[model samples]
Target chain A: MLKLDKVNSFYGRSHALHDLSLSIPKGQITAIVGRNGTGKTTLLKTIMGLTVKSTGAIDLDGTDLSAQPTFRRARAGIAYVPQGRQIIPDFTVRENILMGGFASTSGRQVPALVGALFPYLTENMERPGGLLSGGQQQQLAIARALAANPQILLLDEPTEGIQPNIVEDIQNIIIRLNRDEGLSIVLVEQNVAFARRAGHHFAMLEKGRAVAAGPIDSLTDELIHQHIAV
Target chain B: MLDTIFIGLSVGSVLLLVALGLAITYGAMGVINMAHGEMVMLGAYTTVLASIHLGIGLLGAIPIAFMVTALVGYAIERLIVSRLYGRLLDTLLATWGVAILLQQAVRLSLGLAFFGITIAGLGTGLQNVRVPAYLSGVISIGGEQVSLYRAFIILVTILLTLLTWFIMYRTAIGAQVRAIMRNPDMAAACGIDVKRVNALTFAYGSGLAGVAGVMMSGFKTVFPDMGTPMVVDGFLVVVTGGVGSLMGTVLSAGLLGQINGLTASVSNDIIARAVIFAVVVTIIIWKPSGLFSYKGR
Candidate 1:
């Protein structure tokens, strides 16, 4: 559903992503794993147009989106939930969720669909985002991305800093979205256990490049200990 | 006293208009818009040229004032402020320069003359007092005398404030705007055009200042230095209210207004500002973030 060809992104003189070419097929979860500073977040940011790519072509389906602004890509069915739940602190819980479905506002049935995911949003529509716990925020963030009804959802560390109990909930949510709705996702996670639950497909990034990638069953304990398990 | 309350209310309304926009631009966008004061000045000048020179109706001129000043704000954001945003201190210095240039231009064009505004909206209820030709005269409220024009101003302000709230909370555009203010990236990821929303926000903030300028022109003398005083108070109000809280701005406006009005009677009019500032300092010591700081720093 999404393709990045020889895409190179930069932050000033430092090259964050080097000739990174990756494609995410539709109807399944695609996990991108990496150690710190390996450009995992940078890759998602590049796809979202959050960080300007120095060189490459990004195409969603067929239309080129490398030059398009972040908003344009989102409107084109590419929703990104960046690292750290970027929930508006002051906005109400419902308001935060409503913001996720901004692209859906133009459609006829999106509001109803979004409301169906978290009835609590419809329940406590006035509660601010700051009042929610980390787990709730994670749920709100993913629910928001789902609201857009996007072809691709870029989730950068959804389980980071979340409690273990909530981790299971988030894991179930991700699995359900992938299994039932055929939601395509690019989940960046540090916890292999949680990432394992979220999806079976994995791509390991190291030092600004996609070093190793394949079906989850092909990975061994040695690779996990060396690259991912700190 | 009732008199103090009346004065405070009017003063609060003025502060509300001035700082209300800043709550979003600076408080939310994190852009220290030192040029905010100049936007107010520009708004005042719009009224000066439109009402006194073009002979437009006060009610009609209000929207025109918003449009013209909003255009200036849009231009400033697109051509200038947008580039400087995020560099808080640099944007501040750059905008101050823009402000100085605007003041000098206004000073050159309008000359150093203090002229009175002709009042047209005052009904027969306001025509009974002994007042200056330009002055709208005093109205009896709580057995105390206050300028009828100022009272009328209070009503308009209340109406405008209500409208502002409705737009911020109830409207779809407002939801998008608050989203931008809350988290620009998430807002963008949600398919909101942050730049466009930002321009509209700037225009809205500056436009409110323009409305206040029309009132100031009608009530008091328009001097180059007027923007400085209003700006100082505006910064204080938005600061006291909290970074991104509309309710905080409203509450601080009343608190600061009463402090200025009551203190002015005991001390010199100039000293009132010093007293207000002292009070503000004291408040900040107790609540550094603000009266309504939304969440984590």
Candidate 2:
């Protein structure tokens, strides 16, 4: 399990996240839903140690990760797919996927899971990542994350700008990852209905603070209207 | 004309060695390493020391000089450059300070006077390296006269450039370095150790500069201020060729060297220098992103 206790995150003293605490359970999907600029992204970056500064405890499994650098955090089995899918444009698709293998303790190689899930990436192994469509890029990002062989996946709006048809395909992939692969996932999502459908637990954030958090059944429409609805 | 072209090629080769280090460090880390030329100065001094003390020839000083400069580069990166990663101006200033310290250290024989022990052939003076008997004279090449040492310089540069290309394009460390060059944060996120790679790269670049120094020692006067002008010439090549583009650096060095050589033969050194500067300014104004800027996703 990954846990954040009273974490306060800052971006050069702007104070993006204030006294936030969360427990993301193992082998389940936890959706973080909130309005725009509500620190959903900040939470993810804080976990990755990408923020300007942060205070408090970030424990992955039994170890404290607060002092660890980003690369070490990756080796600790937390793979992040950032908002913009920051894959190297000049790197080939195969190279992009293999990049994540750097974090794996076992050594570097594209996992068999990547080839099984996205045959398109394997087929266009020599093609530059920039040539791929948005939907394809999303697939590449997930494939890249999977190469790390991580226990938990942190996805920040994986389908935000993807096409409608590809969105359903991505949604199914997330479910399969959580259920079949038994991987824990923290998904920061905008689509409330999809969040309710896929997530077992939910956290509602407001102005950088969690306003409501519990099982998906406890996420009432009233709570959504109070915190998320703009 | 052939001799002039050969001279230009040899001159361009030395410039290529100097600029390659600056290109990689500046392009990858966004650092303006003003002390880069000091690595060259150190390399030339290494040759002088090795020849006088160890009784070795210029060829033997090559690897020794490379190792010495690379270690110094590593220390500089770890001590100063590493902390100032994103601060371009601060790095420029700090490295410039380092350049002065290095120059003065060599000039003063490392201030070893405090220990009351003096070493031979070391303190405060101009030094010259003797070319071996084989590389001392002009050689006949297809009815044209060519300086053997100049030819040696060109060959050494070509071999080193090819080695650099192989390292960057064919090795795993090269991939990691390139990945960091493009996106340091993302590279770190992917679990590549950006800091380690950067330090190694800085050392390698310094090593190349040291080799350039050795080359210069053979043909030019070696002194405390010798590296100051080399830094200027190196940056000129980097800017005109485009920052971070290896091919751009190679081609531009050749172009500028030819321009300098041809102009100097017809006119004067001052006029040739003025012409080279004018051409660089024109290139900068014309293509600000450089001749071959990398396109990102």
Candidate 3:
């Protein structure tokens, strides 16, 4: 389980995430939904400890991670696939994927899971990541995260800006990882329909605070209109 | 004419050594390390001290100087530069302060000067290292005589540069560094310890500068302020080559060193310096990002 208790995040002097508390159950997909600039990205970054400063508790499993550095937090089994799929452009597809192995206990290697899921990336192992199409890069990003052998996967808008044809493919991959691999996932998604289909739980964020949250069944259309409809 | 070119190659070799560390530190960390030159100065001092106390030769002093200066660089990163990562101007000012402090510490004999005590190989006076007898001799290449020491300098630079290239391209540590260089936050998110890699990178760069210092001590007088102009020259190479580019640093150092050598061969050192400055300024104006700047998507 991943839990944030009264967490406040800041970027230099500007407060980005207000006093926010959330509980993400293990081995399930928890969709974080909100409108643009409603701190969806900030919530993911806060969980990753990428913010300049943050207050309060961030617990992963039984370990306290609020005071840990980003790499340490990663080593502790939290893998973040950030917004924009920030893969190293100059690095080869293989190198980009293996980079996440730095946090893994088994060391740097292409996991069998990646080979099965991202055969295109495996085939173009020597190609530079920047040359890949947007959908391909997003696949490379997910493959990179899986290289960590992480217990919890934090995916920030994984399908954003992806080609329409590849979007469904990426969506299925996310669901498969959670269902088949039994990995706990925190998915920040803009497509409410996709979230409703895939997520077991939901958290509605507005102005950096969780305004409404519960099981996916309780995520009423009224709550969506109130906090996320914009 | 051939001798002048040889001289240029040797001069460029030393400049490459000095600029290599600056390029890495500045490129990876976005830090302008004013104390970088002081590492060179300390390296020369290490040679002096090693010769006087340990009876070590120039070759023997190389590793010692690297270790000594690398440790100092690591300490600086842990204590000061680490704190000033994103603050460009503050890092410049703070490292400049560190440069002065290092120079003063050397001049004062590590605070032994106040008691009117002077170490034999240290203080404000200029010091020199004797070139080995074999190195002092001239070698005939294609019926033209060339200083063996200058040739040795070129050889050492080539070896170290190749070694640096191998480490960066073939090693896991190098991958981490390159990742950080391209995108630090992303690198960290990928589970690379950015701070640890940065500290190691800083140490390695300082070690290169220290080696440069040891080389310089053979041909030039070692003084507290000898490294000051070197810092300027190193920056010139980095700027002309493009920040964070190893190939750029190598090529630019060679270009600037050759320019200085060829001009000084005909005119004076002062004119050669002026010409170098003019060339650098022209290049900057022509291509502000530099000759080999990386283009991102």
* Residues B1-297 of candidate 2: C-alpha lDDT, one tens digit per residue: 788988888888989999999999998899999999999999999999999999989999999999999999999999999999889999999999999999888867798855765556566778999989988799989999989999999999999999998998788888888888888887787888888999999999999999999999999988887999888999999988888788888888899889988998899989999999999889889998777667665
lDDT of 3: 0.93
Error of 1 at B102 (Å): 1.9
The Cα local distance difference test for each model comes to 0.77, 0.91, 0.93
lDDT by residue for model 3 (B29-128), tens: 9999999999999999999999998999898999999999999999999999999889999999999999999999999998899999989899999999
Estimate the TM-score for candidate 3. 0.99
Candidate 2 chain A, run of 10 with poorest lDDT: A221-230
Which one is best on DockQ?
Answer: 3
Which runs of model 1 end up more than 4 angstroms from their true locations?
A52-54, A105-126, A193-200, B57-60, B110-135
Residue-level error in angstroms, candidate 3, position A93: 0.7
Per-residue error for A18 in candidate 3, Å, reads: 1.8
Give the C-alpha lDDT of model 1: 0.77
Task: Name the regions of candidate 3 deviating beyond 4 angstroms.
Answer: none
Worst 10 residues of 3 chain B by lDDT: B288-297
- Interface DockQ of each model: 0.69, 0.77, 0.85
Candidate number achieving the greatest lDDT relative to the actual structure: 3
Query: Residues A132-177, candidate 3, lDDT per residue (tens digit)?
Result: 9999999999999999999999999999998899999999999999
lDDT of 2: 0.91
Q: Is candidate 1 or candidate 2 better by DockQ?
A: 2
> Residues A1-230, candidate 1, lDDT per residue (tens digit)?
78889989998788999888887888878889889899999999889888744689998889999988888889888878778887777777676766767676465123564465566656766777778888877777877787787778888888789898777767777777778778788889887876776666788888888887777765567788888777
Tens digits of per-residue lDDT for model 1 on B1-297? 666667778888888888888887885578877777777666666665665557764555678878887887788888888887678888888878877877776665533333433333221111111123444677787678877777766887888889999998898888888888777777888889888888888888888887876666665566555677787888899989888888999899889988888888777679988898898999899999898887762
